[model samples]
Structure formats: structure tokens, C-alpha cells
Target: MTRDNDTERRRPDVRTSLDQWLDSRRGVLRKGIAASTAFTLGASAATGAASAQQDAPFGAVEFQNQTSDGTTVVVDSAILERGGFVTIHDGRLFEGQVTGSVIGVSDYVEPGGADHLTIDLFDVPGAQFDQSQLQNTQPLVAMPH
Candidate 1:
């Protein structure tokens, strides 16, 4: 007979730590966003050159080191560093615009979690990503090359 020991126990299948947090705090996140958006603080002023894309246009992105640091990373807008395109050592080929700015991470669950958060660093003029369904996401400290 097969004995179900601690070493043989199967853990729940959770794709990512970020997903876990989202399932637990769905209401809080939605409400928070609504409340914050409702209270417009400042007027829509003209953004300076600093907010502009400072590097070679990205044709795609491959996330490296995608993990959750017990905090939520909201996909607001890109706060790009005014520089050149970053290349990834072994980054997966992504084809689209990148989202999110918050960078926080704990550790990725190796067995069933992502390895890294890498973004393609190519030059794609008139490229943009659709982020209509973007919500609270797992914190990641990914670096693209």
C-alpha cells in the first residue's frame, strides 16, 4: 500500500504568488482603484521630456524574474529610463508593449512559477500594448536587456 507521507504530499497548484494575492484581495483592489480615480487631485498638466521614451523603441518584451514580494504592483504607466534599449542575456522573445512600473518581489515558486521577467528591447515604431484588463499584479524586479 502507498503511504501518503509529508514528502509525497502534493501542494496546491498556484500558478504565481501574485495570483494568490489577487484572489484574496479582489474587492479591496477594485474599491481602492475606484476611490482613487474618483478623487482627481491635480489638473492634467503637460508632461515634460523626462516622461518620454528615453530608449530605443521596444518591438517586444520578455519578463525576467517574475515573482511576488507580498505586495501588489499596479500597471500604471511606463517610467522609462531615458537611455538605450536593454538586451536580455537569455530573455524570451516578447512581441508587444510593456506595462507596470512598480517593482517589488519576494521569490518565484520554482516548480510552477515563472523564472524571470524579461521584456524585448527592440525598436518598434508605433508599438503599443493593450492594458485594459491590467489590475493588481505580482511584484517583480525584472531587468530587460
Candidate 2:
């Protein structure tokens, strides 16, 4: 009982300090996230600067995964570039379903290789976006989006 009371008293202080720290360090955190190239709704790409091909239109790069449940829609990139996002405010526009998105290219392991967008699908079973929702995607050159 005494330990519980003591912990309860300390919890508020811990939370307050944690909140303050997070508020002050939000930009750094966002930058880290952008660098990782895992963009979810409400999170913008502040680091990876993608410059797409001259004629390619700016759109969401999507992927489809065949899960046991059904097909899951995933958004991997902002068209051809890293920071090529049109906007991140409305998750719906990007088909950002309830689960959220963590984006990347499948072939980032190779320094100079074909770029295939890889998106980690979250909760929603139904969502839509660009590029035919390829089951077997073709590799694109590792060019800036």
C-alpha cells in the first residue's frame, strides 16, 4: 500500500517531465523518423529528399500483400521521391487506413539497385492508392523521387 502510494506520487512527476522532454525534442524525433523513411499519417518526411524522374507524376507508391485475411493495401513512397509527399494532413488522401503506414524501398539494401517500394501495412484491410497494387512489383532505378 505504501509503495503504491509512493509510486502514484512519482508517476505524475515522471509524466510531466517526459511530456516536457518530448515537446522540446519533437523536431529531432521527426527528423529521425524522416531519415528512417517510415512515414505514417501525421508524420512528414523532413529528411529523405526525393527528386523523381522528370516526367513521372507525383502519386503514392502502393503495394499489395496477400494476407490470410485478404489483400492489404500499403503505401510505400511519395511517387518517385523521398520527401515527395504532397501532404500528410489528411491520411485519407493517401489511403492511410486506421493502422497507419511505414514506408521504404524493398531494394534499399543494394547501394545502387532497382527501387521497389515496400510499405508495412497496418490495421485496415481495405484502402487504395497508386500503381495497380502490384502483386509482383517491378524494380525501378534507385533514383530520387
Candidate 3:
């Protein structure tokens, strides 16, 4: 009768050990799934940002001139720089062709006085823009065109 009771006790112990092992494996699988999901989401976000940057309409510096003559001149930030293409949205400047090089940045201030960023536009001849015209202008958008 003592031997029979001992066998019964050992059987329960073995079953408990097996259950613990299975639970540990399930925990490991859950962790692996979480890690994989995080990696996939991170990669997708990075790719989206890169594609948007490539399609961005604005550059480091954009020029907007509203003339009293009812002509508006929109210049691409890159074209104002040497050997770069500036996209002209309206009437031309400097010639009927309307393209210029960006020479440098100077006296840039944050858009909303938020102390965030300052940007200056310059011509290839080293002439800096006053940037006062942009004060009343609408804030630039971050979305790509």
C-alpha cells in the first residue's frame, strides 16, 4: 500500500513539470510575435517618410513674391541655388525664363516666433532676402506635393 501511494505522488509531480515547460514555451512565442510586429511597423513608417521627402514641393528655402502689378512669383528653394532647378509657379523673374540660384541663408527666423527654426534665402550673387515679405504669408505645409 505504501508503494502504491508513492507512485501516485510522483505521477502528479511529473505532470506539473510538463505543464510548466509548455507554459514557458508559450511565453517565448508571444514575445517573438511582439518583436516581429514592432519591426514591421517601424520599417513601414521609415519607408513612408522617405517617399514623402522625395515628393516634397518645398526645399530648404522657398521664395514667394506678390507684386502690386497682380503678378505672383513662386520660386523653388533649390533653383535659387547655383546649378539647381527652381520651379516657377507664376510669372517669371530675372528674365522671361524666371529661374535663379540660391546663394546662401541669412537672417532666418521661426515661422511663428516659436523659437524652432530659422531659414534665409540668398541669391547666387550673395544677396540675402529681407524675409519681411514672408511675415504676412501663410505658414508652409509639411505634406509633399
Candidate 4:
């Protein structure tokens, strides 16, 4: 094949592959931005900084410590600046953080908030420790993600 023809053939293939890769990366970037925004806003809300700006990114989760059947958790409320989900984790505070496996997750919550939210529990796949160790008997931490 002529050098020009070979170059033309390779150009489209490379361009198409690059375009596909970029598209996938854009998706990942969008998701990462959303998550970071949520986490940042959630931190602000926790410190009472984002209470007035309802349109701004913010998240808050509130629930009382209680017992459960290891199958579900009740959150008094969950506030989110955008569409997202809330997760339940063991309330094992170590080094100022909840060092525990996910116990439950709520379905997609729309922008705004939900009252008396109920999250279904399940052993997260590939847990480092047995789920039962943190179930029923320990306090659970509800977080917005």
C-alpha cells in the first residue's frame, strides 16, 4: 500500500480509539467530580457551613444509635445536594474515622432529601472481616455518598 494510504487508514483507527477512550474517561471524571463535590459539601454541612445555600453542593445524614436485625437501618434523615445514595457502615471509630465495612445502602435518592429513610443491608462483596462482627450489636454510621 502507498505510504499516504497506509497513513490514512491508521489515522481513523487511532482517532476512533482515542475518541472512545476519551468518552470513557469523561464519564469517570464526571463521576469523580460528583463524588468529591458531595464529600466536600457534606463536610461543610457537618460543620454548619452550607445550611443556607440550598442550591449549593451539600450533604448531611442524621440518625440515632439503635439496634437492628442486621438487615436494615433507619436514618432519621439524609440530605444531598444532588442525586445520590446513602450508605450504612459500622460505627467503629478508630483514628477519628469509621473503620468498618458497609452494611447497607439506600436506593438512589433524588436531589433534596429524604425523611425516615430505610436502607437495606447486605454483606458487601469481598469484605475483609465478617459482617456479623459489626451487625446488631454495634452502632452504625450512616453516610451520604
TM-score on alpha carbons, each prediction: 0.16, 0.21, 0.17, 0.51
TM-score of 2: 0.21
Model 4 alpha-carbon drift over 4 Å, by segment: 1-56, 92-100, 123-129, 132-136
Local accuracy of candidate 4 as per-residue lDDT tens digits, 36-143? 355446656665544524445566677787776667778998788776877776544222344344667688889999999988776455554454433336665666
lDDT of 2: 0.34
Best-to-worst TM-score order = 4, 2, 3, 1
Query: What are the per-residue Cα lDDT tens digits for candidate 1 across 27-106?
Result: 43433333222222112223433333332222222343343332222222222222222222111112112222312222
Model 3, position 126, has a per-residue lDDT of 40
lDDT of the candidates, in the order given: 0.29, 0.34, 0.33, 0.64
**In model 4, where is the ten-residue run with the lowest total lDDT?**
91-100
Error of 4 at 143 (Å): 0.8
TM-score of candidate 1 relative to the true fold: 0.16
Over all chains combined, what TM-score does candidate 3 have? 0.17
- Cα deviation of 50, candidate 3, in Å: 3.8
lDDT for predicted candidate 1 compared with the true structure: 0.29
RMSD of each: 19.5, 15.5, 21.7, 15.4
Comparing 1 with 2 on TM-score, the higher-scoring candidate is: 2
